[model samples]
Target: MTSNTILQNATETTISGDAQVINAGRDVNMVHGPPAGLSQLLRPVSNATYTRSGPVAKCDPGTRVEVINMIRNWLNRRDKQSVCWLNGPAGYGKSALSQTIAERYANKGRLLGSFFFLRGAGDRSHIARLIPTLAHQISISVPVTKRLIGRALEEDCTMLDSSASIVHQFQRLIANPLSSPLNLFSFFAKSKILVIDGLDECDDKVQMAEFIEMLIDMSQRDQLPCRIFLTSRVEEHIRKKFGDARAQSVLYCIDLAAFDARPDIQLYFEQEFGHIYDQNLPIMRRIPQPWPSSQALSVLLDKAGSSFMFAATLVRLVGEDSMPSKVLQEVLDSGSNGLDPLYKQVLSSASPTPAFHRVIGTIMILLTNQSIESLSLLLDIQAGEIVFELLKVQSIVKIPGDDNKPIMLYHTSLRDFLTTKS
Candidate 1:
């Protein structure tokens, strides 16, 4: 199908919240899901829903359309050899954009599968979890392979057998099914895109680099029809790997920072506030107020420093507790250092006692980027005790999941602000 037609049909299908079913040819029919397993798999373990709610800010619709068009083109192209790298700093909405595109294609009966790598979530860090998650996402039965993989595990397994170094295993598992003539094109036809987000956040940078190389190899060989769309911070290791010869001609790299941000940021915040006001406080609804008042938004825009997380956090913090007037005053007075006001608000809400502060300070100093268990040892405190204390103030401290390892700040800005203070 043409890209435009695919987009239109996809949008229409989504309006009714039903999957588009297509009969390719003969008696062979491909039905997209009313209850797609892939959609359920993409959801974060904590939150099953796909939509993000926040204040509405201006988003460059033109840019968004361009991105969507590019991805749609890649998926529609018969060559099936391209890989798209969408790189951006934390909180730049790269994942959100990709997710939206995946959903649109899935609705249109174009997408085969997708995976979201959530940082600090247990499944995100380990290769064992990552591979199985992706396999499940594609609705490929994995019982036999899962049993083989499980049996390979040993308490004293060498590096080759360890769960952490499962790159070869993943490549084999994904590639073997498509190696056969009968299943090659059929398998590829079923999966139009392989969406992977937050490559930099994966704990083992080395393994992530290997996985990217393997993907590059697979794309070059044209062994599968799937195009990989990866979103990450442009970390050094990833840049080097993508710079390799295999990626030179086939890869399309788009930097998130290069895009104009003013519109999208404005749209995001505006939408968020509008939703809350309309749905929660119908009586208080009025003509949409121009948020950030140009002057205030300019300050927020400047202070955000190209980080959407910073901007969103500030908006949420100020809007939740204070009036518009107060929020504006706080932003203006704080000037370029608006982060402090947000941080302070979070801190105050945390209500950290002298002991809590000491514990936090110690963790901040001794294990600036280490996991929670490491912090527990440095503090000479039980891991559970530390976790309980941190969870009480999670909004400020950024506690990781129970199944996950350590907790940290939602952003580096929080860690920087906390550690630098006397």
Candidate 2:
């Protein structure tokens, strides 16, 4: 099927509030409930039905069509590589595209699993949870594997434990189950895929390297049943690992920076601005038909510099503020270039102080994620005060309703901005 057709179906499903798509050829529907013991350990992304906290970002339809079609074609091809690595710099929309692909395959009962590595999101940001999470999702989606995974867990209770080697987890919880006779016979999909987004975001560098090596090993040996789709910023270690001679045969790589994204950015800005204009029609009635003039859009597009995050952040800022025109002007007027000026604008609006710096700084440099309550105790500040400070920068910072949930930046660029030496 064409990418546009797939997107149209997905859009219809989303609009109906029913995430399920008609299982065209599958014997059984993808399981909803998590597999037994491993259920608690899985850290799946927030998509369609699976419930992980925090907001999920998806590619805006009509945008990213070329990349989407390329990935879809890769997934559907018969004699394709087992692993596809889509890498780009931050804010280039890697995660958004991953989310889009996952949702598309998931609706078709072909997605085995997906894990989006979110920094400051507890287990979601760690590699230790990755294999187990994929195992759990696989079991639930492929029923035959559920029993096999359970049996494996029963035999080696430590298979899912953090102390266990990643190789052990992959072998026992994932490879063994899916490759088993019963599973291979029962789970008869042409393509079963696992989407891993933001691998660079995972906190454990050692584990991340080990996991990539393990994937290469498995792919080389043809031991895994599902194709692996991964998206991440182009970190040195990851690039080096994937660049290994051994990986060349089975690994397909795409760099987002190579694409001319100006057209896509234009489409996104047009649609988003149109939405904003429609929503605030009464207030915006006086504005011209093309509310944001072509000249204004060209300026914003040039500033975007192949970064979707910049475009998206600009849209969020303008849409949320009462004075949309003013927000757009301020963003254009910022003297500095790239995401820094925008980041600075957002940070400055929060009215930074020693206390604010202490709060946000602690979040940025945290070795691991912490909840507001825990952060309060660690910093010796009241939880309410932390919330008050975060409120000013709600556009960039995400403050969860529950104090126990981790506070997170909408994008990692905020931390980069804060840490970069002036």
Candidate 3:
């Protein structure tokens, strides 16, 4: 047996293109086919590009060049470290960077799977779906693993049950299947990658820790077939888990807060504002050639203060409003400091009501995603009334035009702000 794979059954399946190997079982008619079987048991982020939604925001063109290159180099390297951690404070653009990396690698066929955790997004916000989701994606990416995983599930039957342990779920759904000699030989030839973003958003701290421990254990044993890229805020539970010397050996950590993003933020503002100016050209004509005066840009940039969330929120406010210039002026005149002050200003501008408070508060704390209809029924408020209140805070809340889609915060910081002691 080679270090990468067991060669005993290497002759069973021949190497072939995706139609034959990577995308196996799609054409098969069986209701209990491996692909169909796995799909039934997993819940993935439906909005990912691979699914129904469009591509997510990547690094803006010509931005984050250094960090992007660093990760690319790490991926290209032949080394023992199988895990990379990109940790930073909120608003440092960790998710953007992770999305960029995932898309880039997935295009090249080196991506095994990616999971992006989003708070209040139902299964995406918790640990229960993590392994099953990854296993499903893995089965698609490596068809041999799909058959093996299906077999494991059929044999155990309870691997995905709510009462099953994370360890049991991992072993049955991921570890045992990939441990097969056939998988080790073919799929383990080169390094594949798994990208997981927003680990802190997962509501269960104990499960999150256990998941990381499993990764560390696999990395230490040279068992992971692909490298894992993870991103999250430096929360205490997460920080302490990665702080250990043993964990550090198999995992390389990057603190994004340590890097200055002024250059990138400035570039983003220039490009986004340029688009805004072009779209509102008739109205923009009244303003100067550069649109926002350099002084105004300077003031807004200062307020941004290493926070992309602030910059992004302000851009949406200006671009979406009837009078972009007027909104810009209001943002400039606002006296609040940091995100809290800006949040307060936004809330104040909305003329928040008791109903609005109930709605927004419920959004911040909901364990799962909810639509306006569900919320109205749960809170005993009229759906139209809820919609009217949400319209006022459109800058921060994402209310889908489709009533079926869940309303979500534009940034997790909004929830953090609303929940924190004043």
Candidate 4:
């Protein structure tokens, strides 16, 4: 049973003297359980854009080594600049870099918590659960944190209530426990990292601003033990909010776009292109190893426009199509126009079947994910048929481990490509 279910039934058992007989294990868990409101706020890790402990197969390698080094420099120093923003556009490798850092510190025991705020991935989209989730994680990770956090919640259980302000929740749920003398593990020799990625994805402008303010307040004080590392697009809301003296005092900013992506981008094309050649050689013998000629690769690099998404999108398209040269030629001729035509080419090349067209269109416009069975049911088609259609575009759409998991987009640009009227 869920912690909430067990607690609810336990409450009823006291009044009615009978509910379903409670399990001992569940009862024990409930004693340490967060309030029902906080429990409901838990977004499954699968909802995060990057699920694994590290970067996945198609993800470009770690070219942001300097960015990671900069973060370390900040962490090692006694400076009060607790918050660092790795700001960049949609297609830059900010999320990937964030994932790498979280995994690195977490394994070393210096990671207090990691929260990835994905766009359109349910509760993962907002700051509602941010503090509570961090609280629960840190409390469990560092044993002494339990007394500090547990006492706070026990004293004021309404802290997690919907009416509670964001600052209030952070002050109690995050700031209180962190500021205390945490029980030390041998691995925790340094300040821990609290990684919050994709801040721009959270739609609540007001709550977001309040959360930043709270971070600024904590940075000035000796309380909170961990340094905050956040990644987001430089949205105007964040720009205006962080413009304050307090925000500026504690904030360290890094622009991912400022770095050279060419070397990394080149490595990405060479590797993925080689993978496609090896995998699809039997289907089409014409494509050669190191498939795109050196000249053509140069052409691609010039037009990639310093965006990893540009490279990623084209690679996905090439993976799906047997004729990589045709796609390469199209890309070469498209000139400096950017990703518009390449997207159009992919969409226009959709299967002639109406079902396939419908599936692609729906996936493009649908902000969030749905299961294969759910999509089939929603589209009034068989599950097998939906899978078949999705397989045709395996490069762009990511199928989950099972039918129960939602189908996710490989990149958000596909949505922009399909939804816009170009």
Candidate 5:
């Protein structure tokens, strides 16, 4: 399916109000109720879902069509080449494409679950929540697997303990349940898949290694019966893991950077500039209809460098408290490395202090993630004071939507600048 079709009709699955189906069973070993804290351990992490076209944003029209079709075709096919990976560097829109495809299949009732990883966002950024989250969703969607999964959890509550191996948890809590008599024969025959994006952003290197190895073994051996659509940067660790010569035959791969990004990016510039002209008619009353000059468009496109995040950051810079013409002029004057100047603009506008520096440093360098409250404890400050400092640089740092959410860098480049641009 085209990306346009996916965006218009797709909806993500949520567990907020899903009714728990509890039934008594024949086997004495199988317990009915989940163990006291097992459900929490298995609970899906918050803010893991990415909306296709809501507040979070979606792919612009005419973007990622080819990639979308390629993935859909693979998902529809039934074969032992069971894993399709869309790999690329940061800012190339891998996560956006993943969300669009997820919405498409989810609207068609084929998506088992999707996990989006944000670096330094705690559980959302690790393999810790991967198995339980997938198991919970599949049980809810497939229903029959629920009883089997409950029994597995009841048998040994330590299945999800930190000390237990990733392979062990996945085998008992996830693979075994789905492959049980409940749904084995039909699984390989079906056209469904699980969507996992941002694998490289996951923090635990050892766990990630075991996670990928176990997944490869299961698919090749037919131990588990679902297809996986995964996206990540070709980080050295991930690249090495997938490079195992024996598994190469079963892994399908795509590198997004090699494709021509000019056409889609050009269209995005046109639409956004037109919106700016309409929205600020009073300030832009005399601006031309296709507001930006061709010369300016050429310059901006040159700096976009085929990276979607670069294009997006430039658009925001133009629209924010500055005239389009003046911003475009500044952009044209900047050298090939235009993002550096733009980064400086954002930092100067924020007017940082020592405390703000400390808060932002923690946000950028965190090993996993922590919410504002937890950060306060770690930083030895009042909880309310954290957001107060974060507000100064809200443009670059995303304050969470709730009390439970962690602060995050809006783009990977922001982290890049903070850590290396001394």
Candidate 6:
């Protein structure tokens, strides 16, 4: 027999002659499935777009431009290594700004990976889940590690398995992949950027701290060509862990509150309201008014307090009704005390049961400014169910558009009201 026939026969024999019988006279292509464990490794990662519209009033343009330039410079610069830690108070636009940067890099196919830590979201707080999530994004496949992960999954295990430390798993399975010569990092002397947001939201603060320490160590040791961009509210533990002067020097720390991007926020609102008005009021033939005239926008900006979430939420709430003028009037009239009342009004309008007040109360008490999943799980309810109820009062709670993370109160003012009332 010729080598080709012999090879075909051997292939048929491997399948116990089943293939030979099935394809009696037809040419059969011998196919090898992807490497063992590759099935799990090849699952598509998310690169969802997170959109926000308004004049970008919440962040200062000059500051944002400076930050963007810094990041771009870091990416392009050779012989200089850098990390960036973006810190801010809760409700500030740190995550949004990080997302914006990630989106920009993605457009150029230069983004390595990005992970958003949603506290209370199942398993997300653990390094095991975080590493795999990021590796999937970079299309780095580790078959052996995947098998281990699969085995853990089959046993119905939590990421914090007694068998292995999450940090070790991350070092071996995830971080090591980027160090390989065949990987993308070989072509670029500078590492690809990895964005991790909401560090304060991670449930296990100690473990998160350890992860950060390990990352710093790895970066210093040059184990991998990777730089990290992290965003979070300034939690005491995190601040202490990363606040060392030496670490700070190696890492660029930007306070999101320093940015004055009110124009962006206003433009965002105008676009959102403009779209809604055009779609719903086409028959009325009303020419879209220039939104939030300079003075009116300034008033909204004063209320925004450098929080993108707050600005976005207010725009959504005010834009819901056709009477923008009346909405603006009521908001302005409420002054500083009016924000909470607006939230309460929105909540009271949507909730059907008197029990909802208790529910709202419970949510406020449980708020970690992290994932809504934990809250839902704690209440023994489905996330979708809670979200459906919350949507009715969208003016008060803002659900992120991309993922099923917990709903966030539109502003610090809303959270303050809920906490104070409780």
Q: What is the lDDT of every predicted structure here?
A: 0.58, 0.79, 0.78, 0.71, 0.73, 0.59
Alpha-carbon lDDT of model 3: 0.78
Runs with alpha carbons beyond 4 Å of true place in candidate 4? 1-62, 182-190, 282-290, 364-367, 420-422
* Candidate number with greatest TM-score: 3
Q: Residue by residue across 1-422, what tens digits does model 1's lDDT show?
A: 21112332234333343444443333323344564333242232322112322222223354356666767776677663567898987667676677777667667765544665544445554444555455544443323333233333222134234454555555544444333343534454534666776787676777888888877777777754456778888889999988887687667788878877666666665665555445434433442455446666677667766566666676565445435445445656764554566677566666676657766777566532456677667667777777766764554455665523555555545656776755
Give per-residue CA lDDT, model 3, range 85-124, as digits (tens): 9998887888889888888888898887788888877777
| Candidates 1 and 4, the one with greater lDDT | 4
RMSD of 3: 8.8
Can you tell me which runs of candidate 6 are displaced by over 4 Å?
1-36, 39-63, 140-163, 182-191, 276-291, 337-345, 348-352, 358-391, 398-422
Residue 102 CA error for candidate 6 (Å)? 1.9
Which is the better candidate, 2 or 4, if ranked by TM-score? 2
TM-scores, in order shown?
0.65, 0.84, 0.86, 0.82, 0.83, 0.70
**Tens digit of lDDT per residue, candidate 4, span 1-422?**
33333453445334242223324544533333333332344332433433443224323455656777898898787677878888898778777778788777788878877788866666777677777777767766676776777677656757777678888877776666666555544234237888888888886778898787777777777455668889888888887766786677778888888888788889888888888778877754666545788988888888786777778878888877767667767778875645666666665666658898888777766766677877888899988888887777666678676776677776666676677777
- Residue 38 lDDT, candidate 5, scale 0-100: 40
**Model 3, position 335: C-alpha lDDT score:** 69
Q: Write the per-residue lDDT of candidate 6 for residues 284-319, one digit (tens) a residue.
A: 245336644666667777776666666666667767
What's the lDDT for residue 68 in model 5? 79
Tens-digit lDDT track of model 5 for 1-422: 11111122335733233233222243112223433444565787646764422145457768878877788788877777788888987778887788887787888888777788877666777788888887777776677777788788867867777788889987887677767666653454247778888888888878887788877887788665677888899988888878888668778888898888888888899998787777777888877656677777877788786777777777776766447667666677878554666677667766787877888788778776578988888889777778888776655566776646656666766877868957
Candidate 5 to native Cα RMSD, angstroms: 10.9
Cα error, residue 26 of model 4, in Å, equals 28
- By summed lDDT, which 10 consecutive residues of candidate 1 come out lowest? 47-56
User: Which of the two candidates, 1 or 5, achieves a greater TM-score against the reference?
Assistant: 5
For each of the candidates, the C-alpha root-mean-square deviation to the true structure, in angstroms, is: 14.7, 13.2, 8.8, 5.8, 10.9, 9.3
